[model samples]
Target: MPYSNIILDMKGICKTFPGVVALSNVDFQLKKGEIHTLMGENGAGKSTLIKVLTGVYQIDDGEIVLNGKEIRITSTGEAQKYGISTVYQEVNLCPNLTVAENIYIGREPMKNHSIDWETINKNAEKLLDLRLNLKIDVKKLLSSYSVAIQQLVAIARAVDISKGILILDEPTSSLDSNEVKELFKAMRKLKDEGMSIVFVTHFLDQVYEISDRITVLRNGKFIGTYEAKKLLRIDLISKMVGKEFNNIESIIKKSRDISFKASEVNFVKATKFGKRGTIEPFDIDIKQGEILGFAGLLGSGRTEVAKLIFGIDKADHGTIKIRSKEYSYIYPLKAIKEGFGFCPEDRKVQGIIGELSIRENIILALQSSMGIFKYLPMKKQEEISEKYVELLKIVTPSIEQRIDNLSGGNQQKVILARWLATNPQLLILDEPTRGIDVGAKSEVMKLVAKLASAGMTIIFISSELQEMVRCCDRIFVLRDRMIIRELIGDEIQEKNIMETIAQGGISYGKN
Candidate 1:
């Protein structure tokens, strides 16, 4: 229970929107000097509970006790005054300013009615270098530092403002393996200093690495809390997703078993297609009605290649051939007109129109392809949205609901629907299942298999090795912004991919 030295206790927390009961009688407790992780699926009320605790959303019913005293935090300032602070996934500090200036931007030390620049720089340097064991020059612009260092600076500022409690929401989503290690070190140091941390993330491996206690929530209800060491990974997954681990695997296997046959014709033939400083020149041929995968580590040019192919960034070298027609260069509108659709990796920023409704979002690509003058009627839009909403099992009450109101899984479904509506010949999906739950991931994979079986050419890119192995007919192993090796059906195993990534590439002799 980790209750001997309780710092924050939330009981009977309930919150609801117009048609959604976001949180219902949820309970959470935090022990002093410990790292507690909040685990759940996209619609499982993890964010609602954090909002309730941080005063971003007023609870419908509940009580929050901090330091054995009941308190109400009406706003972000009030929460900070009560010794609670939060750092979100994106670094919120100004990159143009010096690291020290960002650390004490609004609240600066004053001497003789002037800002104490020297003292500020020294304290900032000491706090990061000594207190957190992070070595960085505080005088340098924050933009010069990596994302990991910027995140630590944001944490330093939060700790200085509110030292009692810290909430980190998806803090390591953008970080690589090494960067994650650095962040974990800082987290451990803070825990040793008697700070209570509420970590909200989807990366299970990271959760096990840094969490002292784990609290599971599902569908706006409190499941249970357990010591990290005592809770098995499978059990935690089951609790968070309400599915047996074996059953989840079966679902993926079922989709993987769907028979796929490669076509003889090359739907896309790229000859040394690349952009300098992005992805090195590479030649490849994508067959009709097959799923070709691109596997690599973070910053391995997976997204860069996709961007170059889709005309988001025009390639500086080589040529592209679609349906036996050669082209020297292409752009977005031209690609759309040529029956190409792309779903970006970062769905929130690059894919969905948050404020728009599901119907509007679904028709975006189709509308763009048809030209601005060829407006789709409201009735036709409704038909398209309703058809996909049912087909994808989107789980939304109505198509008029804002896309932002839907869960991550449903939002992803809508984005897929947007591409499907255009009936494109070739589709590119980048990390389609990221940041979603296990169930949603399985469903998305199944949908991909179904599409491929129906004679659609697709390019699938994912960081999860198992996913790439399951859905891709052939994979291109990339490293250092170059395609190093290609794995056919039998060779596309997770171990093989890992080995190739570790040892640069597999030896296939001279092709």
Candidate 2:
């Protein structure tokens, strides 16, 4: 096949923050009518590069060429004028406004020097019609629609400007399989029309499904770009993480096996714990020295279940029992006091306090659990920090080091350390190993097993089926806001989990 025409090119791009090289001598090119995927672990400079390209950040070094001409993008407005637009993971639209208004907020059609609602709606519908496969009411308020629809509206808006490059950053993270298929169809249609798309995501399956070419970045450096069809999934992961993906089963199998010893103690039990239109009420039980895995597809209510259990979101109808005592409307603070700790999925937003030091972050949960007036002694704080620094193998110059300065793996470890310092009897980890390197991933899994073996009950969520099968003593399969199946003992296998998820219902059997 003939090489595609180059649409966008960057040469020797470099960006740096205080004491950190975010991107170093990175080169990238996008071809017309092709979906180019940017692959990397978190903090591998993927976000930095995207920000630089979209004028969110000024590149310290590099030249950008668009359509065979050099261009300098100084601001978001300027970038948009030069035919470049970005749709971030979070939908950047006014929730209270109508879909049509959100799509053409500042660029609405005018009639007699006034906003023209009819013309605006017509134009917005045209754009949506050209891009998306489904029909959306242009007059409906954005918040009334589901997340998938809102995401589609965002993409429709981004592509409406006509001659620009569109960048989609992790757009499918929250979308279900059917929604993802719809998004892919739209993307392929856009590619066929000569639009250059830069797709950024952590889902390996998606990269292979939609990308024409794949570009790998590791620790701020460009590894190489290859045709998507020629790249194996394992090879792609190895390149992005700069190491071979470990055999999770082998690692877990080699570790000392801990038999399940039933006890009268029930760490957590929730009956009908769910919010309307969010997650269905589900009952779960965890015993000491057990790692209970929540297995599900995207938007299958795994995170929602964890959130309800952790009190991040209040359950509208349900009863939760901790150690045989019922909790009525328990919040996070109350949960913490009851020896419950939660590590959220989105680490950057919910997990880390970027402004705090490693010691401060580690001590946060403990401090809260201890109450505000009860300050932790400095010596005690140091002792606790040092212990977890060794236990979780957190890498830092000192406990005094700023949490933001550490690498992604180390930062994740620090988050884990934060909860561990709380001395929780039951810990809930939501996508704990996401966006980290292979070595760090294995370390985190081993830490989880260790914690369980020491009689700390744990509930973990992972999108990787193999991980759930390996690390969890029992797996609860969720689909569309309900637990459909529970696999225990020898039934907890990768094939079983995948088949259950594919079948899209609940099944249960005791070992």
TM-score of each: 0.67, 0.69
After superposing candidate 2 on the true structure, give the runs of residues whose Cα lies further than 4 Å from its correct spot. Answer: 1-3, 245-287, 290-309, 313-334, 343-422, 428-454, 458-511
lDDT of 2 at 482: 70
RMSD per prediction, one decimal? Answer: 7.3, 6.2
Which ranges of candidate 1 are over 4 A from the true structure?
Answer: 1-3, 245-287, 290-338, 343-422, 428-454, 458-511
lDDT of every model, 2 decimals = 0.85, 0.83
Clash total of candidate 1? 0
Give residue 207's error in model 2 in angstroms.
2.6
Give the Cα error of residue 505 in candidate 1, in Å: 18
After best superposition, candidate 2 residue 177: deviation in angstroms? 2.9
Number of the top candidate by lDDT? 1
